[model samples]
Target chain A: MTQSGYASERETTEGRVFTVTGGDWDTVTGSVDPLSNEKIVVNMGPQHPSTHGVLRLVLELEGETVQEVRPVVGYLHTGIEKNLEYRNWTQGTTFVTRADYLAPLFNEAGYCLAVEKLLGITDDITERANTIRVLFMELNRISSHLVWLATTGMELGAISMMLYGFREREYILDIFEETTGLRMNHAYFRPGGVAQDIPDSAIKKIRDFLVYLPKKLKEYEDMLSGQVIWQERTQGVAILDVTGCLAMGVTGPVLRSAGLAWDLRKTMPYCGYENYEFDVPTATTADVWGRYQVRLAEIRESLKIVEQALDRLRPGPIFISDKKIAWPAQLAVGLDGMGNSLEHVAKIMGQSMESLIHHFKLVTEGFRVPPGQVYVSIEHPRGELGVHAVSDGGTHPYRVHMRDPSFVNLQAIPAMAEGALLADVIAGGASLDPVMGGCDR
Target chain B: MTIEPNESSTGGVPVSADPVGADVNAPAQVPSSPRKGMFGITGTGDVSGFGGLVRRHPEIVGTAKPYGGYFDEVTDALEEAYPGFADAIEKVVVDRGELTLHIKPERVLEVAQIMRDDEALRFELCSSVSGVDYLNSDARRLHVIYHLTSMTYRRRVRLEAAIPAGGSLPSVTSVYPTADWQERETYDMFGVVFTGHPNLTRVLMPDDWEGFPQRKDYPLGGVPVEYKGAEIPPPDQRRVYQ
Candidate 1:
């Protein structure tokens, strides 16, 4: 067999050789001859910077033009959804928030809304709680978009923009830390309402951000929007038209960039979105430039929403009034910076037996959702973040399927890259802004 | 819809308006019934003979059904547009209060395309595509579920198509482009082929992988615990990674 021209054969001490052959390789390689037109298979990354976290793209290229691009995900699949089934409903928020790390609030909000609708208490969310959710979500949107801008900028060779983008994003993270005690995976939004009230320090920080961010946005626009290199690299590259977008089930900024204003926020109005006044930004040009312009405009619109939510933030109860659903004690930071409000523990353990028992039962058993299913869609930074939550009359979810926009949007990559230049593949992929954590989860 | 009165805090501070309802046990109906005829229901399963009780407030009855969860009025509107809708719908299940329609697998793509293009049933957004293996349940074990939303109506609907193991079904990637990755994922994990998927290649797993890992029947492999100072054999003697 080795003499028959299989290059990979190994010879034994007895002078016999065996050829290992299977998996269409003989046909794929095209000939028994070693010097034939051998197709090259290149693994782009489980470590490449362009892959956006442990994503490996196996590209089959015939000299620069890609014949096939196979995305190898699940390198970051943490099994968070499966883990949610074992925990209580309230505790599940902590897990889902980590799925799409860039847009943590969106994950929490989607999970909470699904549970709230299951409990038939969607309408009971207070204006204050709703306002706070809107505030954090938009702020998180800006932060997520900033990460996109930073990474996309770096990928396109605008090194300075990357630094500036992250620098500004750090400010938003600061606000999140002050409010929720952590920058990322802030599981602040509970099933019925938010975990706690926003503090004065966080309010001041957000107010400062609202005033400061617009000027920074202009600076970012001036740096990249008109730069001939940036324009040439992005404009008219990776064109996924409305038909293609809809067919591929792509949503968020990418879909909007294709000229459809299908924003779930404007369309569905979850968390009292209809009451707020903000435009759903869109672009007519279905290209990389269009995606860039749409996301930039979206940051501005999210700022507008954040401003409105802040102004409407009157003092009120942050959690649901129903004791069964609400956390028995309020969460507050201690010296160790973990939640340990002494007053709350004292009330539950020392002062009131009912409080202690309620806390015990709620923490252990969790709340039961009627055996039914509901799909809740919210506008996340990337696009329509829909949670299809099914409960089988149990304390945990029967099936929790997330319509992750990043995952759906990434399908357009092959369509966008097949005929385009190799360099444009980076721009096209970067513009899509896929987070593999979200994609694989 | 009378607003609850505000109460004063212990320190003489006025408590904020309790926008969340105070009563956890508010008299709302809950869906509690398991679906009947696990497979194959004969001709429109219309209990409409229940008349005004179901028609005037269908959601109430829908919510009250055993295993009944919260029922949305939007699905009710869709029921009106597609005549014989109840017959076409195999099961109306509320899982965590999310509405799921277990439609026959052959009609999955057609119904999805209609939901996207139809003026009233504009489920313009196909949010997620996933597959569930119900090996513990019926013989037709694979359920390809689609979560769709209408941006115009601010409504949502679940479209489900079930196929027996080793069955091939029509692909919806042609109708909703986003279905491509999802269908590919389903094929990768469940071994349920999407007949006409342009690039139905392995997504998460390598193309060379032998079995679908997500199927309930697929064995979850584990390694034997090695003893302290145990002799380990080379590659040829060791079992291959699954």
Candidate 2:
């Protein structure tokens, strides 16, 4: 459909004149045969901006309504899971953080927690490290939600919100850069603790974000929350009942919107989430609007948590005391914009021979986790991000399986979009927020 | 009192609990011995001595076995719940701290259902379903793993079922409901059939795809091309790409 303000016309030889509407109505109509029993196959992605990231949906259409939607993933699969088996335990964190690009901290935390549990040192993680983890995770949650808002807005035709959302997200990335030395795929959360301590400059930036984001959130609400077009496009579109959501393993805002407060953070506390004070946002409508409202409310809740975490911040050791489990030194950005801290280099070269040897051995071979397996799950921005890591009492993992929420949640598309208008597919898919990198990893 | 040799073998040592005879399997006592270094412990003498120790304490013997990666507290709980659970379980492994119980392929769904419905063993949330191909293992190479969580107890368990290549196993979709996509994914990747699954169509991969890619035996096919006048080999041909 070209947005040219005119309906293209066509004529049939059966003494009837029919208008061929939009671009290539013949191809569209030819793809479907009204007389035949075969369903029309419509390919929706791989290049579509609304499919999140390189996701392809093959929708079986019956006229304007969807009959079935089969999502085609793995176009972004980088074999991160298979590759983890080849690397040492410590090196594995760098790979996992790249799985869920939007919420890298959560991925790292879940992976590291599982490894720590295997090592039987879950209780040994320093309080400072845990608190920093909570702070960064919440920050990651906010940043991820902002991307969701931005992309969802763009998909729903609220173009300006896209720019506004990215502008706000840039501030969060700036904080990440200052602290972890990388914006995306920071790999900041190590097994026993964080890669580096938070800098005062980063803390000030986060405080600034805490003040700046709430006002911007309200501005977004003012702009689109009550707008007629936004309401029409989102409200009552792609309604997913609680049964459908749970059946499809769709958790997070979408499931929360379906009137089920099934957040892993509240249901199963990890990393001292039980100590935090924040409300789990829910909506009863179970529609696109419900998901939108739930996510917006969640942003507010996350902001509150971040503010509390910032206030609770105290100076202490950021890494675990167990030298075997912890990274050798805090990483800093190199001249080439890669991680290369002075402490790391000094330990590698100028330190005592034994110290240098230990550092080299630990870095190269990594510590062996006791032979066991652990499944560590966290409430990611999209949904439940679980890491099923299995160690064979070796330096490397035996099997590292990531239960990426985006991948599982994307299964709800056909259930939600079937029998709905084709236009609703965009709304439904955007509401699911399936990041392809995470899904295909 | 002197203990019977048969009773000792069965780990049925009797202890006084409140003056009543309680059958508590007392940890087998060992004589004070000289410590052995790491390398020394792997010698023939140490191996035989270790084997003798196992012969004495059979209950704690299997606990130290070198499981590939399937390890977790759930395994211990399952063993406690069903005495001789290791016998019932087809395979018990400790991988990375995640315990995997490879149950009989047929009993997978039933075991999963029981795990969910039993109040004491409530695995309320089916967190993830995945598949792995152990081509170098047994003939039944396809392994389906289900990660279950009990929100109430704050514990997690993994249920694994393996099938021979082209064989089918029971589906747990009815038990957890979340196993729908996971089962499909297993089927898609490993060609493991999940009987009685509601929707067992291919997910991620196209419906008409020919081979299961995740299996170790399956060649990693790729598009070969020339990059800057240099020939690029397929994935299966390359050991490590620069």
Candidate 3:
């Protein structure tokens, strides 16, 4: 054993010493190296506070730098698409609204649009209904962007911004609660039209919200825009240009932030968005800061849309007159929550047998959509929320697939996170503003 | 056709005066049964007695020249740009103010490439990729639909490719990188394999999860909870109107 490469081990000293000229430094350095050369795998969460709602990022990091990032989602997959198959055409609103909790109206609107398209009743949808949809959707955009601002701000060490963001969001939710009944996941939008007409109280609340949000938005800008920490964290960080955004199908504030005015509301106008007098906001930085600025500007733009929608709102039917497609019982806020209006219920049940039968049949069986497939995309708070609905001439949907913006936009995580500092990963992921429910639906 | 009393009452509900029956689920198969209701549930108890009535699913039919709006322009540009236009495109369907090009499954990638690259076509963005399962109706039941949007022309065209179960289709990731996750999701839901997709894995479903959930045959799995000892069937097992 001792008669190896280094002649012999001489025991002149306290311990045996051997000097070798032709030593294998490669193997020596490779085996006993520090954690710097050795790549470390970090699983950031299916359950962590900062990763934004059940999103798990598998990051291979070399110290502070992320070598590779693989986002492992599906923690919040409730099988909404599969569940939609089991539900009726009207019941689908309830299911779809839950997909993206933040922007539930957009989901409902998209699903309803697809259903209307399938039924060939798109043109039949009332002008008042379209205006209502536009109004609520802009409000939802503001609330969603507020959440984005709050969460991203919190992630990047702006704790006060989160509280401010949520405070403003609560105001919008109050408006939603007044009209749609439930604050979030309101199945207000139906296939034919909306569940009910907007009450005068809700209209007043919305008007107030429109006025209140602009001042708060300005306060948020004044608070966070000039801060050194905020600037350092967001500016020039998580940069994904227009080309990348387009290639990855990223839209909404993220795409707008990249300087491409490809807003679906502007380019592919839906819900009478073309008539609204508002600008599509954009920022050229294509970074976290750009997204923040774009979202804030969009809130201002949305406020303008809300005002226009309010002005455009006339005394007309909120739902289509189609008795076959329409939900017979007028939905109203009950003590227990949203249910059929008491007056309508009394008339249907006590007064007329035909009315009772009609209501029962419509409520239970639901109206059939002729066999056809339609794809309807609406600009959601996150991005382009597309609904691909197919009907097999049944009460229930044959197949309904939602191209959720959160789901599509989450793919850009690796592209944004790789080669960036570990801290920037939080900023980039926050900037995407992914609702895991939507991403995993 | 004897209109039931319920049917007559329902007719009072305002439907469009002129419904283009040709556009919707056109019943190719006329039911032999005279009883009208969903899934053969006929008579008074049922609300909408459309069960026994067979709906004709829309078949892939090419519209004649003036496809109307920008459809004709798009089809013409694609026809001129792509060499094997006739062989690649099975049918050019214009319905609901939307242009649908039913392309051969094997030739989908080529068509997508042409749709994206060709200067005239200029379909810069592939908006969505989804799968639909037409169980028992068509031989090629699974269809992969690509919604292509052209920023230059402000036009949207739907490109569809149909294939049987366990069939392979080329990935259009090369042409539209956005298809990366869309294809995976489609694969996860419908089990449609995209041959060239970099990572075609289950997106929404758990890695170890069993079967594609969105397929018609796949049941919406859930524990049936009894209410006051009354056994209410799960949604999939319930007596559906259709």
Query: What are the candidates' individual DockQ scores?
Result: 0.26, 0.22, 0.48
Q: Is candidate 2 or candidate 3 better by lDDT?
A: 3
Instruction: Give Cα distance to truth, residue A215, candidate 2, Å.
Output: 0.6
**Can you give the lDDT of residue A181 in candidate 2?**
77
Candidate 3, residues A225-327: lDDT per residue as tens digits? Answer: 9989999999999999989998898988899899998888888888888888888889999999999898888889888989999999999998999899888
**Cα lDDT tens digits for candidate 2, A1-441:** 233344544446775454545466758777875655546899988889899888999998877788888877878877788667656788888899998899898889999988888898888888888889999998889889999999999999999999999999999999988887788988888888888888888999998888899999999999998899999999999999887876677889988999988888888788888888999999999999999999999989988888888888788887878888777655776655446578767766785788777776677667877755577888999999988776645677767889999989887888888899999999999999889989988
Candidate 3 segments whose C-alpha is farther than 4 A from its true place: A1-31, B1-55, B222-233
Candidate 1 Cα misplacement greater than 4 A, ranges: A1-40, B1-88, B91-100, B113-124, B132-142, B150-155, B163-168, B187-202, B205-242
Candidate 3 local lDDT, B53-72, one digit each (tens): 65565555677879989888
Instruction: Report the error of model 1 at residue A28, Å.
Output: 24
Clashing pairs for predicted structure model 3, backbone only? A45-A56, B26-B56, B27-B56, B28-B56, B37-B49, B37-B50, B37-B51, B37-B52, B38-B51
Candidate 2: residue A230 lDDT (0-100): 96
- Please give, for residues A244-304, the per-residue lDDT of candidate 1 as tens digits: 8877777888889989988878776789889888898889899989988999998999999
Per-residue CA lDDT of candidate 2, range B134-177, in tens?
54334565678888876567666777777777688888888877
Largest TM-score belongs to which candidate? 3
